[model samples]
Target: MQLDTIKSPGGSGSEELVPSRYAVRVGDIEVLVVSDGVLPLPTQMLGHNADPAVRSAWLKEMFLPQKAFDWALNAVLVRSGDKTILIDAGLGSDPDLHLPRAGQLINRLQATGIDLTSVTDVVLTHMHMDHVGGLLVEGVKDRLRPDLQIHVAAAEVKFWEAPDFSHTAMPPGFPDALRAAAKQFTKVYHNHLRQFDEEHEVAPGVVVRRTGGHTPGHSVVRVASGGEALTFAGDAVFAVGFEQPDWYNGFEHDPEEAARVRIRLLRELAGTGEMLVATHLPFPSVGHVAVDGDHFRWVPVFWDY
Candidate 1:
């Protein structure tokens, strides 16, 4: 069935029965997790370093397909004090990639009553096309505020200048597409780029910190307010990461370092019991980490209606 063409009972035009956005209140700060649709990727992207048989076993354990599966793409919208901050822009339109199901962030944001111009600041976890492409969408730049500041790690900006894909194991065409998208994004938004060394606060209680794992400038954003907190881990952790913390994801530039970073972040989250949300996790991926023997576990929070 053509799900996208399905209309609501009231005939309110094409609308998805499945939710695309979920809201969670971190004390006084308001955070919304928006889905950018899903990307169908090969299962090997889960962990290229893992034994093929072992990886297949894990997929079977999770009741997932062994060949390919849909990976969730999520972005966050944070309202703290007077600022409306976007944590990551979702995958924008990439006809070359033929990922038609993804890149729904713009339309979904509008459906949520969020105006592009209202965003005061943007905090990028990294310059991956999926994380920065939404801003590069046609006419997206024109709608955004001229003075909008995009916060990113300085190291990330430098790394992209001569990005090395020696360590990555992505599907064909991904590397080239990523390079082109990053270059175009940098050229178009260079003036608004706000490079930070280690960490920077984009708004009250919203801080983005460099972790340097999946990418040289890879980072995570932590939102804390009124004694509650949540971390938006962009590409650091994945669905299979908990069970196989050391497994090398196909997108990591430095697989070993990425594994180290993942373990460290997981340990921290498990210890603190803070909410965790990751870029490629399931939609509205709000959850907590738990120590599971030698590795870790994902304990998704119970939905609140």
Candidate 2:
């Protein structure tokens, strides 16, 4: 796929496909934010119940492009103690996934001067292809080491592996093939895969919080140290969801419950002042959420120098 010269509607850039990475320190641990790539999704297809006029008006008010919104595939790399942890593996380097503008994760990681083999853990936010695709390089068997343990929510794994689960509807943005491939990928790494239930700490200062609704087992990673905390909001919040936390997305496995979880999470984040590290927000997806009367506002973090 060819790179376009389109400016970002998400306020992150003036050009498409500019590689980005940002780093933040939480006490002694370092959380590095990197992009797999950007996904341009049509605005109309997002908020299923939102009136077109209202959606358009919201975009206009925010100065966002009316046609499509650029969603970044942001993943976090955490270095703590002696372990090197990756929050979400990105859309791997593959063209067939139809993510024409994405799949730059491997190169981005290499650019950071971090060895692939040094990666001790990979914690998946969910089963979505864009989030888990970088777990392996396409057709490269030796790229990832055998000791790298893959962590996922047990409920998420069970839902996907169920016999009839795929027969049902999936989130709008997810392709059936991609979901099937994700399941197959887990099967291949069954021995190395570790599934957890509820909230638990998998690494020092790194904990996984079960925030379902987006997916059956969708969850977020919370990294806290000292008095500072950062939560990888996962798909709990995205795009218009920032302004309309109650507005459900077409990609939600359970729309109603998703909205509830989103609103609940937003309120908690706003009250506690925990930095929200979103996966689909603009690039360098680190920011804070503020409660604005009946709604919420996303305040992107200042670029760390």
Candidate 3:
């Protein structure tokens, strides 16, 4: 399938489904954007401290839809030589999410002619439900590729595995199902899991950096090959958070620390012109971050087949 073509439920020209796959070549590495699906988020979920009036006005000025915001659930597939690395498993095959249209990562991969059995490594940016939920399918773990090496931060494993894990610090309206899903993840993948700290290289060209805030072990994956580079920027920043580095995400466990890490890393990435693939940007979430005075903005790469 071409990168620009969207294959969904109803054939072509149907609005029910958006393009779920995009491909870009960064030097010697091939990056594929695999989308599970889009989720409808309430605009009120944005955690900016602006007054109601100011927030409403800002949304109007941006010409955003009055109701809900659309957040794309994206996963990055990095093919470097012989290694096939998947960053952030999407909403898996479970139909329980009942989300309008989600849990399509494995199907989308098959549609794109990518073999699931060939995926050698699975690196999770954090333990968010959307990122780690796909680790298991229908309550069964490692079903996709049992031998796959699953990598995550040591702190994240510790947080999720604690017997008395608490959600007190999580944002309002956070779903308890996520905690259950994470517990299952820890139980099933414990044997295949590899925990790493900062600057640990997982693949030939991929390195993990500690950029916590969203979660204790939240981190970003940096891929460099043939003098070109890109980053899988986990959940460090989202749509408006790009422009307002101080804005906290409702899902953040440590809002203060999340802001600190987001601002600090964004400044460096923006200054360096490093390409980044956001987990929750629009489809084909790859983009470049530009420093806009005291804040930053996302400049999406032009679409190409």
* Top model number, TM-score: 1
RMSD of 3: 3.4
lDDT tens digits by residue: candidate 3, 1-305? 23234343344433344577787877778788888887777665555454667667767887887657777899988887778888988876445556757667776776666666778888999987888876676633434677788889988887776522242233334456667778878888788898987658877888888777888899899888888888888888777777667766667777788889888878878878989888888888788989878788889988875
Q: What is the TM-score of each predicted model, taking all chains together?
A: 0.96, 0.88, 0.88
In order, the Cα lDDT scores of the candidates are 0.92, 0.76, 0.75
Best by lDDT: 1
The digit string of per-residue lDDT tens for model 2 on 113-216 reads: 56678788888888877777776566433777788888888988887765233322443535665666578678677888888888878788999888888887
Residue runs of model 2 more than 4 Å from their true location after superposition:
1-19, 139-141, 163-174
lDDT tens string, model 1, 104-187? 999888766678888999999999999999999999999999999999999999999999999999999999999998999999
In model 1, the Cα lDDT at residue 247 comes to 95
- Ranking of all candidate structures by their lDDT, best first: 1, 2, 3
- Candidate 1's TM-score: 0.96
Give the clashing pairs for model 2: none
Clash total of candidate 2: 0
